[model samples]
Target: MSFGSFSLCKELQQSLIEQGYTKATAIQQQAIPLVLEQRDLIAIAQTGTGKTASFSLPMLQLLTKGTAATDNHIRALVLTPTRELAAQVGQAILSYSSLTNLSTTAVHGGVRIEPQIAKLQSGVDVLVATPGRLLDLYTQQALSFDKLEILVLDEADRMLDLGFVDDIRHIQKLLPIKRQNLMFSATFTNPIRLLAEDMLNSPATVEISPETSNLEAISQRVHPVDKNRKTELLIHLIKSNSWNQVLIFCRTKHGADNLVTNLEQVGIRGASIHANRTQHARTQVLGGFRDGSIKVLVATDLASRGIDLSRLSCVINLDLPFVAEDYVHRIGRTGRAGHKGLAISLFSDDESKQLKSIEKLIGRTFTQTLVPGFELAIKPIVDESDDDLYGNFEPDPTYLKQTQKRSKHTKSGSNRSRSKRR
Candidate 1:
């Protein structure tokens, strides 16, 4: 259905028209009406399904008709998992609220707090924030949620995965219980459901897509190569295909950095994003990648959660994620907003368990291909008996030795206690 059927404010309709969004996505269609009615909502939708606009539009309409209280108390507060996402949500609110008089600001860590405090004190109608920075501002009394009308948790699943549950609960306790509650995520796993039970109040549930599926426009494929040769093959693919923009996912911070170094050594423009990097660096890397100045962006799963890249052409899995659900979110970087994209995974024999888990999660096997010159000389064996492949891969000898030492100490302590008793 068209966005016009939602009977939004004339100015909002005009804004949508100018932005070239005539039709509503499935989640938008179902969610806009409930949100306009001022009901608590739990929206389950994928990454690129226009979930941002679904709530942003309705929120603008709600706030425009209401009056602001004294002390510039925040009217709406949106909590996201990452700084990039907070910025993106703030931008969306600003763009959609252009015709209105509402003011919006984004607060997150890895940046100066004085400016954000200044903005908060000046009065903001909507505040988008990451949990850590928000807590900091709250503790310093730089922000107040006393007049909060609506509370939105965008990407709730990611927040939970990032160990933000305690932060979310703390924020929830500080909010006014009467405020409108909204929770949106890509999937409703058991953990997500448990978290929703605590946050939502008799919410209207909306699920736009199947729980375990990625976008249909993305073509998934796998290239079987040796563990050491994956980076070389990645450079080969990007150079051969002349791909302009690519997002590569690595399992660790070191892996991301190493991938970036390798790509640069081969004459490809690449940047890495991880927890160790400052917020400014991450933002710069993301901006460059989105603007097509950077050819490849290597990032860990946590660092890449909030990245919303429009028309991103390709996503390469340099290291398969240990969790199956992450695979959906990784490839979701591409095939956004009805655009066709490709997702390629570089898999080695050691990662077969991860591959199997992903296949089980997505309910399909990826089509495997072999690179001509970089193919594995000796195929690595996969052991079906080991369920925890990621945990069992003891690559660090020092760590294993430490574990053994700890065990021996514990046994000796038990024997000494028995001898003393005798």
Candidate 2:
């Protein structure tokens, strides 16, 4: 379906055309009409599904026909889980509302509150914010929910993962009881359904399965390497494959920083984004990466949320996440907007549990391959005794089978010479 068929305002339709958004994504086609009808909705969508546009487009048209916000008041609120996501949602709303006079501003922590306060005091039609910062602004009387006509909880699952449930309930209590509520999540887990019951009123649900062709847009492969040699393997792949604009995921902030440092020492332009970094630094690094001045962007999973890079063709999992669902979100960073992309994971023996969980979740076994010199040095020991199953489960026959199969796919004789800084 096309944006024109959504019965949107002319300005929004024009904006969509100019943005090159011709056909509506499945999420957009399904959710936009519900939002336009002012119905409470629960959208189950994954990353890179044009989920932002689904709501933003309808919101722009709806807000254009409503009463304008007064000082210290907002007409609509979009709550996100991370600063990056808040900014991303805010930007999408702003971009879609370009042809209209609707005002939009995003507020989040890690930045000065005084400036956000100023933005809210002047009044905004749409306020996109993180949970904590929104509450802080509310406590300071910087914004009011009295004028709120619509409430959107974007990335509901991520908010729960980040432990924003209490804040969400608090914010809900403060909102006008008679208003439209929309909740969007990657999954409709019990926690999300419970939250939806609390926030939404007999909402309509729209779910786009992640196992669809959207996932097929990405080519996935695994490289079996030692834990310590992941950095070397990453560098080798970047140089050997001549990859540019790679987004690498690390499990910890310290690990992300160390990886960037290592990459820089070898002449690869790299940067890191994580919770520990100031918002300013994170924004600067993202800007550099988007402009091609930075070859690689290393980020923790939470920090990577809401990062939308159209040209990012590759994503590397330096360390697999403990949560299997995160694997889907990480690779979703690429293969976006129907573009073909690549996702590579550096698998180690110790991460067998994570690997197994991920394969089970995605319903596909990754093709394991070994880089010539970066192959594992010590093989994992298998405990065949049935009695020791629960006690020693790290190295089972499944892991050994995968490892043994990996040896057959090792690349031919090649130079092990590591790339150096030119």
Candidate 3:
């Protein structure tokens, strides 16, 4: 349905028009009207589904009816899982509420409080923030929620995963209990359901897709390669496909760094984002990646939670996440806003457990194909006597040391791990 059909304020309508957003996505279609009516809501939607707009647009409309906030008071609140999502939601609110009298601000950690405190002094109509920073601001008496007409917990599942339950409860106690509450999550796990029960009253429920479900618009596949050959295969895929932009996922911060280092060997410039990087550095790397200057961006699960890339055509899983639901979030980076995209995973023998978990969650196995000549070939780890006992990759000192510990868990007599699912 077109955004024009919604009974949104003229300012919001104009903002959407200027941004060239003609039609609303499914989640928007279901949630916007209820939200504008001031009904509490629970939206289960994936990333890249235009979810940020689904709530922001209606929020602007609702806030128009509320009186302007004075110093330290806000009419609406948006709590996000990470600083990046908060900033993104803040930007969207600012853009949508531009012509209105509403003032929007986002605050997160990893930055100074003086500027944020100053902004709070001027007051904000809509405040978007992470749990930690929001609590910190409250402790400092920099913000007041007495006038809060709406409370939204965006990415609610992630917030729970980040162990913000106590903080969320604390924020809840601060807000007027009778106010409107909306909770949005990509999945409604038991934890999310419990949060919703305590958060939303009699509410409208919208489930565009389940947690296990993936976007049908994205093509999903897997490549079987040895753990060591993953870097070589990744370089080959990018160069051969002529992919100019790609988002690669690694499980750990160290892994992300190592992947970027390996990428440099093939003359590929890459940037890594995680907790270690400062706010300025993260912003610079994200800016470069968004502007097409950086071809590859490597990130861990927590760091990748905040990244939203436009026309991000490819996502490569150098390492699958341990959490099954994270796979949904990873591939969701691509195939955004109805645009088709590709998600490729480099499957290794050691990652079998994770791979199985992903398949079980999604309820289907992705296509597994072997790259000709790049197929996994296990060479024996030659001993001091040059005796090949356990076939591993090139029996080098480093290779032997790494695989020696794993040789005992030998499944069957063959050194080669099975390429297909059992």
Candidate 4:
């Protein structure tokens, strides 16, 4: 159905039309009505499902109809997990509120607090902030939530996974118990459900899709290779297949940097994004990747959450994530907004457990192929302790050596001597 079906303000309708969003996504259609009715909501939808606008549109309408609060007292507070998401939601708020005089500001860490304090001091209608920075300001008496009419926890699952549960609970204590509460997340694990039980009061539940499912438009493939040969295979595939505009996911900041270095050495112009880099560096890498100046953009899970790339064609799993649910989010970056995309995973024996978990989460077996000339002669070392169906029992000398070293170090000198003598 079209957004016109909802009784939104003419200004909001006009803004939607200008933004070229005439039809409501499934989540939007289900969520907007419940939100406008002042009911608490628990929304579950996959990434790239237009969940952001579902709450943003209704929130702008509600705040605009109500009286503005005094300085430093925000009427609406949106808490997101990451700075990029906070900025994105803040931007969405501004876009929807552009027709009116409602003021909005984003408060996040990794930047100075003085400017955020200055903005709050002047006054704001809606405040979008990360939990840590918001709490810092709250403790300093730089902002107030006493007048809060609505509390939104965007990406609640990620917030909890990032160990922000205590922070969120503290923030909840600061708000009035009678205010409307909305919790939105891409996945609803058991932990997320328990958190929702605590935060939402008889909330209207909205589920647009099953949990931990990937977009249908994306084609997923796995290439079996040795851990040492993954980089070589990646470069070969990119160069031979002429794949450009690829977003690669690495598990660590150091891995991202090392991957970029390896790609450059192989004549592939690449950039990396991680928490260690300055905000400017991250922005530049993202900008370059979007505009086609950079061939490959390697990043950690932090980059997987909030960066939006409309034309990202390929996503490579340089390192499998420890958490299986994250695999859904990593590949989601490519197949966005109904566009077809490709997700290629380079698997080593060391990651068999992670791969099996991912396969189970997606509810299907992935097609495994070996790239020509890059096939691994040595099998991967799957932990025998894991009961994964896909687990292959292969011995790894490195792991064995480490295990032996640990055992030797743990043994007493008398026991070691007895064993050596025997």
Candidate 5:
């Protein structure tokens, strides 16, 4: 539906138009009005679903109509899991609220606290923060939640993954008991529900898609390569297919660096972003990637949740993700905002267990193709016995049969598919 139909504040409607947001996304269409009504909510949606705008657009108006905020006090709070996500959400807040006078600031770890202290000392109507850093600031008396009117937990599942449970609970306890609460998660796992029960007051729920689902616009394929030749295959595909820009996901920071080095050795422009990289370095890499100076951006799961490169069209899993949900997030970097994208995953026979788990979680099997020259050296051993490969993890017969049916469609040929990057 159109933004105008939402009865949004004129300034917000103007911001949406200036931002080229003519129509509200499903999440925005459903959640914005309820949020404006001050109802607690649980939003089940993925990154790049205009999730930031869904809440930011209406929250800006809510804060604008409410009492003016002052230094050291906050009217609204948005908690994210990572520094980059906090910055992205804070940037969204600023961009949407630009036409209004609402002050927005982001606070997170991996940066100095003193500057954030100064920002908070001057007071902010909206504060986007990482849970750990928020707790740190609260302990230092740099910020106060006494005036907090709305508390939003964006990507709440990621916070739990990052061990922010105690911080979330502590922050919950400090908020005004009557304040509004909103929680959004990629997957509403059991733990998230428990936390929601503690936070929400008969909240409304909106589910656009499950974390287990891949974007229909994303063409996903799996390349079966030996563990050692995976890098070579990646290099060959990049050169042969003329991939200008790609986001490569690695399981660890060291692996990300190693892949970048491998790409550089082959004369391909590559950069790496991970937890080990300094925030400055990470920012530089992201900036270059966005500007086309960096052809390949190798990163870990941290970037899976943080990076919001709408123009990125290709995502390569140099290795299978440790968690199935991470696979969804990695591919989510692309195929955003209704744009077509590609997701390539390279796995060896040793990674069969991971692949199986992922297939089960997503309830779909990927079309597995073998790159001609980089084909597997050793085939995975079949479970000859009746016991499950993963003990006690019984396979779903329907899913297993569906996987087998899909695998039969694999066509042996070149691995790379030519497509224009967004």
Candidate 6:
């Protein structure tokens, strides 16, 4: 369906044309009209389904027919789980409202609060923010919800995952009871439903199949290797395939850092984005990765929430997430906007549980294969006599054999020189 059928303001129609957005996706078609009618809505959609536009476009259309905000009071509020997602949603709203008179801004932690306060001081028609930062602004009297007409919770499931239920409830108490409420989540788990029951009043529902839309465009593979050899196998795959851009997921920030260090040692330009990095550093890394200057971007599950790169072709799971739904979000980074993509996961023996959970959640099993040269081998038993005075033991011959076999594929000859993207 075309967006023009919605009879949006002329400015929105012009902005949509300028942004190259014409056809509306299924969620957009279903949710836009409901939003326009001011009906409370519960939209279940994954990333890459044009879900952002579904809500943003309609919200902008509605706000245009109302009075503008003043005295740091916002007319519409978009709550996101992460700083990156907040910024992403804020940017999308700004782009959609570029030709209109509405003002939009995003606020989150990890940056200076003064600048965000300054932006709120000018008042905005729409405010996209993380819960913590929004509360901070409210406590500091930087903004008011008195003028808030619409309340949106994007990625509601993620907010629950991050333990923001209490904060959300507190904010709900602060908002006017008459405002319209909209909730979007990848899945309608019981917790999400309970939250919705508490927040919405007889809301309409919209849903998209997770497997059909999000995963169908992406090719998936699982390489079963020993836990210690994942880095080695990943290096081999990238160098051998000559992959120009890859997004790798790690379970922890420390693991992400280590993965980047290993990649760079092999002449591959890589960067890490996680909670430990400053907001400025994370933004810079994302810019480099998007522009194709960085070969790899290693990130944690939480830190990867708002990364929306349309052309990103490859995603690797260095470590499987503890939660199954996160696997969906991880691979969702690629294969966006009808583009075919590849998702590779390094499955180790210890992560079998995580793999099973992910398969069960997605309703499909993966093709498990071993990298030819990096196959897992049984370690030979070593005698106590092998230990030296310092209690150090020699390398196991079995492990050494596997390492040598893999080294042949990772030889320096294939280590082509590439300039750093930093």
TM-score of 3: 0.87
Model 6 bad stretches (over 4 Å): 379-422
Q: What is the lDDT of residue 204 in candidate 4?
A: 80
TM-score of each: 0.89, 0.90, 0.87, 0.87, 0.90, 0.87
| lDDT-best of 2 and 4 | 2
> For candidate 6, which ten residues in a row score worst on lDDT?
413-422
Estimate, for each residue in 1-422, the C-alpha lDDT of model 3 and write its tens digit.
89999988888888888877898877788888888888888887677777788888888888888678997898889999887788778988898888888899999988998899999996799999999999899999998888889999999988988899999988888888778888888766677767777777776777664321236778899998988889889999888897768999988889899989988988999999887888778879888998999999998886556887667879999998776668878998887766788999998877666776577556586667999878778632323353542223222232223233323443311111111111
Cα displacement (angstroms), candidate 6, residue 401, comes to 46
lDDT of each: 0.80, 0.82, 0.79, 0.80, 0.81, 0.82
In candidate 3, stretches whose alpha carbon ends up further than 4 angstroms from where it belongs are 210-214, 379-422
Instruction: Encode model 4's per-residue lDDT on 321-399: one tens digit a residue.
Output: 8877788788888877657889999998878777876766665788889999987898666566755554442222332
Better of 1 and 5 by TM-score: 5
Q: Tens digits of per-residue lDDT for model 1 on 113-154?
A: 999998888668989999999999988898888889999999
- Clash counts per candidate, in order, are 0, 0, 2, 1, 1, 0
Sequence-dependent TM-score of model 6: 0.87
User: Number of clashes in model 4?
Assistant: 1
Mind sharing the TM-score for model 2?
0.90
Per-residue C-alpha lDDT of model 5 across residues 1-422, encoded as one tens digit per residue = 79898767888788878988887776787888888888888887766687888888778878888887786999999999998898888988898888988899998888788999998897899999988889899999998888889999999989998899999998888888878787888766668878888788878777664431237778889998888898999999898886668999999899889898889998998999998899878878888988999889999998998988766769999998767668878898888876788999998877776787777756687888988887667786756463465443334344344334433543311111122111
Kindly state the number of residue pairs that clash in model 3.
Answer: 2
RMSD of each: 11.6, 10.7, 11.5, 12.6, 8.3, 13.1
lDDT of 4: 0.80
Worst 10 residues of 3 by lDDT: 413-422
Which should have the higher TM-score, number 1 or number 6? 1
